[model samples]
Target: MSSNVAGRVVCYSVLSPPRRSRREQIISQLLTSVGSLREHNRTVRVVVFWLGSRHQETEDRLRSLEAQVVHLGSYEDLLHPFPGGDVLVRYPVLHKYFVLDAVLEDLGTSQLLLIDCDTVFLDDVDKLFERHADVDLAACAEVGTVRRERGYDPAYLDEEHLARLAQSLGGRFVEPINSGILLLSRKGIEELAKLRPALLEITLRLMVGLAKSAEESDFAPLVQLRERLASGAPEVKGVAPLGFPSSNHWIVEEVALWLALGLTESLTMRDLPPSDAALGGEVYRRPRSASSWIIGHYFSVDTAPAMSWCRTGQPPHASPKGRSRAADELPIDPALAASPLLVEHEGFALYEDLFGLDVLSEMTREAREAYWGGQEQSLTARFGGVGRDSHPPRRLVSAGGGDVQDAAYCSPSLKAFLESLCGLEVEPTGRRGSVNYYTRSGDFMGLHLDVVQCELVVLTVLQDLSPADDPSGSWELFPGQVGRPLPSVSTGRRDRRSIKAMPGQSLVMFGGLVPHRVRPVAAGQRRIVSALCFRAGQTALEPPTVPQD
Candidate 1:
């Protein structure tokens, strides 16, 4: 099928039945995303599925952008109680059903793109359709436990109870999926009809019975509690039979539902067009083409700012010229610094051999199957790299009241590394919550100084370092400038001194002074570990140096 068959893409966010401020912010972000689409002369319909009385000004704003604005009124009149009108109204599940109903009834087009308003589209996403064939739904992988991780044992679920629940709901176990970015084709809409009533019932049980709060866990029930509530309904029980493969562990159960329902077999990115051709922009084509894309997810209110890139050299050490060291060794001890406490260094040159000379010139390719491997139960033991900042400031803490730096479902090695870097001595300011990990073809973070309050910037590159002639997986940093605009130098002109960080090695840079970014890894191999550490202080503290070059 031609790429244009992707049809006019419409992105929307269903705002709360309450909270005008949140609704406004969501509308603003939607508008901003639509504005980018407008600039490209694309027919991108933007809508806000709101609750309260519609505002003309808001509608006017969307109209000015030449995008559609929709406000889905409360359905209380259609059904007596409006099922979950109060507690579960803000959840996206019902809104999804409402939209699905419209689409199936031919009120809308063949393809629909639903996005969480919290996300900002750095570029056009129209290409998602071209690659989608045979798949009813297209979505990013939900990071979750594999069968191996789950230990193939039926005991994981109380079999008797699970059987009873499965019989009632018509499924066995529940898998997870991130509903943030959902791509539904016409086939998906039809399939959704088969599962709609059961799914709605499950969603309501989750919202009212299990989750109760706006924030919910995967296991929440939906059926209303009478004199005493029952354990679960048949639809909830049926989810287990799906047996979906868990890719992104963040929303494993949701993905499980998709797979259990036999929807997983219908999707693929193989046929999707390149983002550039679909979005129709210069910036989308070049991975490092834009500063905003380089600083992925910056200014997001959810998590602390992290320098999420890699380098190809060794850890920072005291230079013999600066202090009094040998010809070959880099300093790891923090006490050796002569300037105040934390000394700043910029560019990749200062970080020589960080990856080890031998490791820097090699390829360590893991099996592709193994590379994509993940687990759940064993997650707590393996990749935990370090402990996080103790005495975490209120802003950076999770709703769980734990440190925000903790990537909840990560391996133990990651946790250990986090613990080592984000000790009680160093606490990150503006630490909001755990960060979502993301990557793509030739994907990487570009050079920029971090605005967050952290002492050391640590990255563990996921891929092995290739030869100098093939530096596909090395780290690069821009020198002299801290959070400065892209220099007016000619295209392809780059500063020579920045270091290349290799896999397994870590670089602890004075984040404030060192303006740095990662070079995109086109193909070959590359991996990275990022941890932002801050200096200890009684109150919010700033680095003594200004961010200007």
Candidate 2:
């Protein structure tokens, strides 16, 4: 299939069985993004690659859309068959490879642009073709999603794995780009295919044994890098990855606009208008444009350990509404502020004046209850409620756990809060950050600070009104000069701090020098607050107060 029209290019990708609610949201985003192309009549073709026994409902929906739909038969025919889980993890990479192979070989189209399903096309991306034709491949430069020791540490992977990734990337980290979005020329797609065999070998090997999470996909680029290193090639000599100077780093769609800003990094608040009403608080009409609003790390939040690869917090839907503190009512006594304010090591300043304090309070209260309430006492009982030694309540906290930990998962309020803070509704990095819970008896998490990978934490305490013994329940740190606990919060402890967080009161700790521990609960009944930790840089703004007439 040859492109008779000069402007024709294939735009393709895939989506498999997703949670019902998520499926709707992603579908809406996909249609919204692609709808932009319709104005140009640019003949945009979308290919959705799905695996497993086909779901006619899903296929029908895709077919209903004007775009093309390709069901790649069974997952087995696609590659060394991995479980549905493994398949889902590598689905994007595989889908791109399949689409490029099909589009180029079957349609004979050389030019292609691959956009992830989640993207929303605010403007014509056709310019991507115009700009990138000069380079063999063009992609948004690698935004450091997860912090890596302030420099190119590259410590996550060993030599063998790194070498494999560099090799698979075809001695070029340029093409196959972010896979979230990219523009690939015919040669680029062909080169991607050429590297498929080695890439698949590594993918299968990792999926079966080595890979722990989606990080396996990095192997493609690592293999390519290894090849270059083995040949003693200079880093700059290989294919180049395009850098968009003006862009905010996180996963959200705003990165596209940042790239649109181009050369001018120094953006005043006024330069970049609020992306939406939700962002108005954190961003404003600055007189000048500095480099502030553009960069990946600035907007990142902590998530699960495996997700440490990117800073975006857990998937947008997973975050809970963490507590909010009002700047007007200083948590620390202003009289005590004779010198620079002292907070925990990771602590950072939070403003409640610009963003409203009430909205956050209401939302946090509701979220605290909804999350904990949704889980059956039976389930909480499964972990041993207060002091049942028979079950021996494990301190296990994970994405699936529904305690305050659910805050790691964003709720609508949480998303609005973050959008206000970051000035955009950034995408959530698919990482699950840590959440800690302490129960009576066998249910205690010993004193500990989060790992480097853990960015920020919001601690919210929810306990029964009735209390007993140990007078424990207070957040503790190494005893100060008086040998009593001192609690100044920071990241991993950010958010407002509140003692006696009975039914509604909660605390949030941002970055700082604070180390904290929960006091023990009485034997009769135990108290618990769902403690949630997020990837760093992914912070939120309180909602503005609505003035009454």
Candidate 2 per-residue C-alpha lDDT over 103-216 given as tens digits, one digit per residue, 9 for 90 to 100: 666455656766655343323445445545654455443322221112222221122333344444344221111344555666666666665544444343333322222121
Residue 443 local lDDT, model 1: 37
- What lDDT tens digits, residue by residue, belong to model 1 across residues 1-549? 112233545556453423333344456555555665555446545555554467777778878886665565654432235433443332323455555554455544577666555343444444444445346665432222232231332322223432344445555443323355567777766666566555544444433323233221212122232212235544233332322122122233343244245322333322222231211111121223322331012121321111111111111111223543221322222321322323333311123333443432231221111122211111111111011111111111011111212332133453354334333233343232121111222434443344334444444343443554555544555444322333321224464344555544556555544444455444333342334344433222444221110
TM-score of each: 0.44, 0.42
The residue ranges of model 1 lying beyond 4 angstroms of the native Cα positions read 1-7, 39-41, 53-57, 75-93, 105-108, 145-168, 171-176, 205-451, 454-549
**Cα displacement (Å) at residue 183, model 2:** 1.6
Candidate 2: segments with Cα more than 4 A from true spot: 1-4, 36-42, 50-65, 80-93, 145-177, 207-549
Q: Clash number for every model?
A: 98, 82
State model 1's lDDT: 0.37
Error of 1 at 123 (Å): 4.2
